[model samples]
Target: MTRTPAEPHSVPAELGPYLREVVHRARAVCGTHLVSVAAVGSVALGDYRHGRSDTDVTVVVDQPLPGRTLSDLAAVLTHPGLPCPATGLELVVYDAGFAARPSGEAGYLLDLNTGPLLPGKVSFDPAESPAFWYVIDRSVAHRCGLPLYGRPPRDVIAEPGRADLLTALRASVREHGLAEGHLGDNRVLNGCRSVLFCRTGHWQAKRRAARAVAASEERFRPLIAAALRSYERPRSAATELPATDVRTFLAWVAERVGEAAGR
Candidate 1:
């Protein structure tokens, strides 16, 4: 049932034309059930890096579609109907009720993520693990999410409270371990962003957060600088900071977040 992405719709110029076509194809397949389509993460933040960022998309449906219909929609998105501009897409289809409900679990009916690390392949999670990242994403979307179609992000996503967000951030760091390999840059930057958010209730992109903290926290300058190089540089030139340093940085971040959370 996989078909090519076609047609085009108006969206942010940064999303480019290929993605716009994919959006149109997705809507065509979903028909009346599709409620809203939004761009989250870096693309929505106006800081998307052509090769380094993933196109994070959230699709809301009025109700659960039939199994066949869901499969078709997935095919439309994953079939490489258009040349993807970034690494690839991390798409989630959510039921309208769950989307509108005041919960931060995501409650998605379908989840798919693919990228250069997983070229021409996708990971499907019908029952994704509980993570604070989802909560953070919703919060970002509520504040500055880009709507491609349908209702506004605020109406579609419930506002996650600061207390809950902090709790989730702490748990995420404790359990996920410090990410390694290509994810090392994001792991460090995200850790910094989480700590800053806990202290300031402000959301920031990874590079911005790294710079913000590194400016005032001289102790973390080396670690943050290395992360910035890896994050901003091409993958071939990305540097790996020593494992011990990464662990130390993460430990420091965890402690700061815990103290801020009063845990």
Candidate 2:
């Protein structure tokens, strides 16, 4: 059953129906709060190289839950005959306060002063990002769609004003990064975005825009130096900054966090 991901048995063909099934199951458990759901990850991005890709479905609730509650949501995602590496799912509850902070959609965190999901306002404006990240790929943006709540904004995707088919992948990216302490999100997208552009080269503006965020090239110095030096370079060559740079940013972020706490 686990064949290399390629033509003939392309992932979408095999996973499309299976993924929809999982979403249905998730919807059943989520009830009113399951505002949206979709297929993400290797399948969504058309890059399931070999052996097992999880079907990451995101459910944005009407209310955001504490980090601990998200663990409970993880348990609910598992069920029989699921094809994903594990019935993996990402659950984000809407809270205006949290939405106002930076976060990653396709796994890139940002600094949001507004925008919350689940019973809160979730803004997807590209203007708020500091030079670190800015452009919003339609596909990635599509993944942020609140399907359960109804369709998402039509303009944020690749084919401006066209129906979106990439939201599923972006939604999964959100949770995928969160699950792996964000190593999965950041590292994965650094490469994913690269391939994405290779395939959808038309949206140069959006790709370049994301470069600002990916500019944290030094964000995972040791990790990047040791692992894959995957670079998504439309905006900048930030995939290879020294690891120490990332550490410095982290420290700065920590101080800001502390300042916020003190106030």
TM values, all candidates: 0.87, 0.36
Per-residue lDDT over 1-263 for candidate 1, one digit per residue giving the tens place of the 0 to 100 score = 22222223334455667566667877789887777777888867667776677888887888988777777877777734554666777777778777776564645677766555434533235445565657777787787777777777778777677677777788767653546234677778888887778768887877888899899889889989989988887655667777787788889888988898884
Instruction: Count clashing residue pairs per candidate.
Output: 0, 29
Off by over 4 Å in 1: 1-14, 119-126, 180-182
Q: What are the clashing pairs of model 1?
A: none
Error at 3, model 1, angstroms:
24
Candidate 2 lowest-lDDT run of ten: 111-120
Error of 2 at 215 (Å): 23
Q: lDDT for model 1, please.
A: 0.72
